[model samples]
Target: ILSAVDTFGFHLNALDLRQNSESFEAVLDELFAAAGVTAPDAGYASLDESAKRELLVAELTSARPLVFPWSQDFSADTERELGIFRAAAQAVELLGPGVVPHCIVSMTGTVSDILEPMVLLKEVGIISFNPAQQRLVGSVDIAPLFETIEDLKAGAEILQELWEVDLYRGYLRGREDVQEVVLGYSDSNKDGGYLSANWALYDAQLAIVKACDTHGIGLRFSHGRGGAVGRGGGPTYDAILAQPEGAVRGSVRITEQGEVISARYGTASTARRHLEAFVAGTLEASLLDTESLKEPERAYGIMRDIASLAGEKYAQLVRDDSGFIDYFTQSTPLHEIGDLNMGSRPTARKQTESIGDLRAIPWVLSWSQSRVNLPGWFGVGTGIMRWAGEDETRWQDLRKLYQAWPFFRSVLDNMAQVMGKASMNLAQIYSTLVDDPTVSQRVFNTILDEYELTKEVFFRITGHDSLMAGNERLERSVQRRYPYLLPLNAIQIELLRRYRAGEDTFLVSKTIQVTMNGLATGLRTSG
Candidate 1:
């Protein structure tokens, strides 16, 4: 629907499972409605083979590229879902007039063993890769996890094994049918926790780059990132530039997710600006690869170590601490997320009360509400602060990283937004969920002090008051959203109290669902 001749674009490619029997004309009518070409549809879109083909034909005639839905993994039983995606791609290929079909692959956690990446390429016949490694580790500590160096070595072994099985090994090395490989970050980061996830991702990308270089593969990495930095959301321009040299070769693709899509692409001017940032960021990264920007190996190692320690502390708080899970579930509106019906994906994999079973949206959302925002910046400040105090060279490397690497810079930028939104005073309003006042106070005070110290360190490094510079619109938007959030928070608190006071189970469930709906609508993003 975005018609500007900018470096960005989007198209709606609906695959309806609820009503796959609808007629072609009826579906075309629906696309018209969803795209706002006609009016908003009174009903959701339907999925019919003929209808999908017709839509694809129409889109192709307009020179628009269509992204096929491949959200379901290989084991999906919804034959309709599987059939529609495969059929659409085949139609695109057979028509083959001028349109290029985009393929996507996602892994579901049900697989007892790791999935072979090449299976996706063989089955789909087109490569659109986004692996969900982070979600795989359900009950394990992911941070400081690789501190023994053996972890990295073992990871390398996995990389070698994957290289043997992946189509990229053949294609990047001059085999056929391999056009691109997309790397995922958000889900993986959530699974690995912050410190481990970030490092793991960096290592993975670096390894891929090495593989491509060694084999002469023309690889285009499409980053599956999200709206918040904790979910791999950050300043796009800076993040792209931070790529290890030779990793990015002008071509880049990243997901515009959740609240960020509306914030950046909601309007004409803002959308155009967003496109410009991508083009600008890609160019800057491509042009600038110099010695001054490189982190000394020793300094980088120290930063990694501090990050590992910090991540361990963070993981211990969330995963190992007793009653923290109860506090999380009872203190926030997370229980209601499953019933909210906001996203295409379920909130949990199965019926379970564990944090590992909880979806990342509600996980990040709860922390965001309590104002702890553990995902955005839990270990970072302590990691950096500790490193700076101990070694001057390490501190210098941190500064260079902020200035040079797009990834580190984006991390800091996201932290600033989190700080602006989070308030310890307001968080105290929600902390009353914990019956133990001493524990509540201890946790709250520790988080708040760390947040402040982190902000000071960030300011010292970036010399900025906040993330958005000269962006009054964003500031105003956050302010407006904050007031709206307060009502949802109060509702959640009341609902929780009643539920605990022996309220009817059904009523409690409905209340939780309603609270989720209101909060998601108000925030405009799940987290």
Candidate 2:
């Protein structure tokens, strides 16, 4: 029974020499020693000596895989150098014998120079291109950014050239090599519009998959998905099932982000259920019906175009709006979130006073706290409503897409859940935080109007009045806990007002933590 189940695993972080004084490699080695390699059911272990090796040779040979996260934009400082080396060394040692190492490339800081160095470290196996970096680039014309057929082909060509050359060949330090790349949805969509990021990623993955197939190299894709739809949320089963046939043929990995980690695996039973779901979903997707694959490519293209147009509109409203940032800061308790100090990383990369620099976590957190959850459904509601505006043909196509494509359907279902929990009226209570009535009215009204339209569309599509329609337990749970959570929001706002007034840390830290705990408990996910 244990062997029948796929065990759960957490992605580990290597202590970069720059980030830590302690040896991260040593720490990991210790973890491996205790945790054992290849999980018990798989019986994968990293044996140190001949006797131990002989004892386990029959049970395990290949090491469990390792996933590495690297910052592409790190400063050219001692720490950055050390971090890169530390991560690389760890992967070289830990990966193989059941370990697969992956590198996450942050597209923000030093992207132009990042790829060249990566070609030298081909043995590291997986390298990801994060579109979230475009958010930090502050580039106005972001349309030419999607990874294209030409781009993937070019990258592959570059790899082939490097493999034949001395510079990259010498740097690899003698190991067989293959590379995998990942695309991020959270940071990318948060920087770009939701639809834009989604399309860019879809296009990129499809391009890469084809490129690998043409080149006769194994291709693996890891999706950097967050907890909500706006941040790349979708149903795991359907999402995997809808993959472009061979795109996810053999292996895959995705970040289990905020709330999702707790929601899916807070307990052992839930963990088992979720793990089984992934295995089941992946297996099912690997065997999709031929009819779905036979659907005309033009049909898919039309949906992509509609999504792109809607994304453009979404970008206009959020990124282009002049005063929306001010309204975002004032209306939401975002200021306090920084004071909360919940995670290991900073909310923003620099200490600048702009929302553009803020990380996706806090951005999502702010809207969640305000009960607007603007990130999840902001542009989507408008896009969908407008999509329904043009003609019955488009609407019919969209409805059909929603019904036929598991990916599209999963997106809608996620939004439906997010929208149901969202309370624009409750969000309005915090509107006094904003001084500009026009900006407030526009932001607030736009969200409220879109919510009604979204709910209507959702009802029409699902033939259900509201989300969780048949699940009374979930609805009742939300109802009972909402009142408790509202007070936390109120307290969070008051604390933020005091902190901003130049008061000491006494109130802000305590009150913020209080609210964090309460919300984390009440909502079952932190705001």
Clashes in each model (backbone N, CA, C under 3 Å)? 6, 13
Q: Candidate 1 residues 353-450, lDDT tens each? A: 56557666767776765555667776667767766876767666677777766566656776677667666776776778777776677667766777
Q: Which ranges of candidate 1 are over 4 A from the true structure?
A: 1-159, 163-179, 290-296, 351-354, 390-397, 435-442, 460-488, 499-527
User: What TM-score do all the candidates reach, one by one?
Assistant: 0.69, 0.72
Per-residue alpha-carbon lDDT of candidate 2 for residues 51-158, written as tens digits (9 for 90 to 100): 322322221212232322432232245244445644655654554212323334334121222222232132132322223331111101101111322333244444
Candidate 2's displacement at residue 42, Å, is 53
lDDT, candidate 2, equals 0.56
* Best model per lDDT: 2
The 10-residue segment of model 2 with minimum total lDDT is: 135-144
Q: What TM-score does model 2 achieve against the real structure?
A: 0.72
lDDT of 1 at 30: 41
